[model samples]
Target chain A: MTLLEDILLLGLIVTAVAAPLCKRLMATVIVYMSFGLLMAVLWVLLESPDLAVTEAAVGVGVTTILFFLTLRRIHELKGTKDE
Target chain B: MSKKESAWTRFAAWVNGEHEPAESRLFSMGMGPRKERRPEITLPKREEKQRLHGFLSWYPVASAVIGVILVGILLATVLAMPSFGQVENPTNNEVPAHYLQHTREETGASNAVAGMILNYRGFDTFGESCVLFLAVSCVFILLLRDENNTSQKDLEQAQRREQRRKRRQDVILQEAARLLSPFILLFGAYMLLGGHHSPGGGFSGGAVLGGALILYASAFGQDAIRRFFNEKVYNTVRVIGLMLYAVLFGYYIFTGANGLENHIPLDYGGLILPIDIAVGLVVACTMYGFYAMFTRGEL
Candidate 1:
């Protein structure tokens, strides 16, 4: 395999490991987002521009925003619990 | 030592006179504190229990039948492997290749993806966009409940009670959001219109616009946003968008032209107006509906 492919594979492995290892829920979500971003890059490399665009937009952009929003809501509920 | 011997003699006399020696020993052992007596084992008294046991005895038989069937399937798959491998890959070498070669001149679009989506498969795109609209409408209906008694009233009451108890902070962030919302909406529209030739499209643009509105609502209040663009207005726009798509497709069919045929008069344009407009409207409504549901925490 090419050096670039090997490097990307290593990065993906790290992301996979780190996602579960992250303690905070928000940090875990960020790691998952990075995983998705990497997958988009992989899709582009595989010569599927349409899929890449979709992954970047729906997977990374909209879904990440949704996750962040939900996380914030969870944080608010946690605050209420603390009170 | 004499008292202990006397007690043992008395116990031996009681055991010998009252019961069998084995029974007497068992009783003594059972009464000892170090161990507890086991309950007497009893046979099933109910007919139902006997029937259940009979039924359970067939479980192994059923498992054996399933296992045999699975083995048969596995053998069949193994035997069929060569035939499956020998099956020809269906080729569209003649028509699709010719179509691909002729597409650029016919569609007048630089991007093959855009041409394929907007021109070749326009009907499917229209249907998909309509599905999005339908989904958002259903979500809206499910979330909003009866209009006569809206959730806004409860929110208003809560706000009033909070205001009565304490002074609310004058947030500058809210004020800035309110100011920026219109520009965001305009940019979203531009993205929708320029989608055929540019990077941005209906879905992205609509989401951005809807997000901007959500920001405004959160900053000011739901009631404030509702005053300008209420449920009725959104519903109307959604219906209008769907109707426009239907009309466009209907026109194409009636005129004996294929659906998604570029009828729009633009120099070097591949976009049909109906698709762009329909997608834009659907995206906008969907995004808005999602935002409304999300902010209200219904989903």
Candidate 2:
């Protein structure tokens, strides 16, 4: 369990630093969403399932959608050939 | 003399105190009126321009470096803190002890957290609902569009975009949304109603409900959602949810503060359930309202 927590904490730090470093806006949003996922896991490990659920829903789910919508609106996601 | 030389001569004359400052006169002596007196902007030399462009290209990298350093500092600070759930931790105070010991009896909630938020500190939850309400209202003010605000060309462009999307409909997303929305909505309701006895509560459950709504909206388009969740219904739900919480919690505070027992047979569990539902409604509306206002600018 300690090992898993250590790995998760490391992942959290990596994602937190990598999000802003991503060149593409899409990659940045995805990295940030992953950071949220790791935080949710941390919350669960800390025995606060209430916070875990809220974090997953608000952080990973709604906020990511909102970010994608804003990106699309600003035309930052245009001309992608990635079918 | 050229314009620059004459302006310099006028400045030297003014410094000598030969006459009045000639502020208005000198300003009016430009090519035309004050508004049209444009200053000549010279571009930087080649080397300076190159340096500026290089700096511009490196700005993002510099900011990213600063961000990483800040994150490192924060991580170091967090790592140095006490571990979670330690008995000697500062958070292991009498306040939590009291809440854990007496929450079930006083609030009739199996979940101490739900009891804490919805019963003991219900006014705080009510304030959060008000914040959500005000947030959606602000978004509506900033983003909601109607015939007056939307232009004909914008409407045409939107229609064209919708048509293009309809032409290239993502069948997989639509199918998944159709298959999943019902279960998602059911789980959200369960979380909301069972909040007092479970780990879930209004915020999470309402967020899940909002996520389901957003998925359905994305797959089925605005017209389909507007059939049931029109602007009128949205406004009514948001306003009614906040008002209900305010009135009920206000009554509770008044009665409790006055040291008067309730005439009604409503128990703590009943009060918590209603407040949870009210909060759920406000949060669900806020999430969906933000999505709708951001995307379609109408709901």
lDDT (10s digit) by residue, model 2, range B1-299: 69999888878776554545646676444565457667887777997899899999999899889978998999999999998789999999998998898777666688989989988888788888888888888898789887658999888877887897899999999999999999999999999988988988889989999999999999999888999999899889888888888888888887772224554333546577888888998999999999999988888
Displacement of residue B230 (Cα, Å) in model 2 is: 1.2
**True-structure RMSD, every candidate:** 24.0, 12.7
Worst 10 residues of 1 chain B by lDDT: B83-92
Error of 2 at B133 (Å): 1.1
Each prediction's DockQ? 0.23, 0.81
Where model 2 places Cα greater than 4 Å from the true spot, the runs are A79-83, B1-83, B257-268
- lDDT measured at residue B140 in model 2 versus the true structure, 0 to 100: 86
Clashing pairs in 1: none
Model 1 stretches astray by more than 4 angstroms: A1-13, A16-24, A38-56, A68-77, A80-83, B1-99, B145-187, B257-271, B297-299
Looking at every candidate separately, what fraction of the true A–B Cα contacts under 8 Å does it contain? 0.03, 0.87
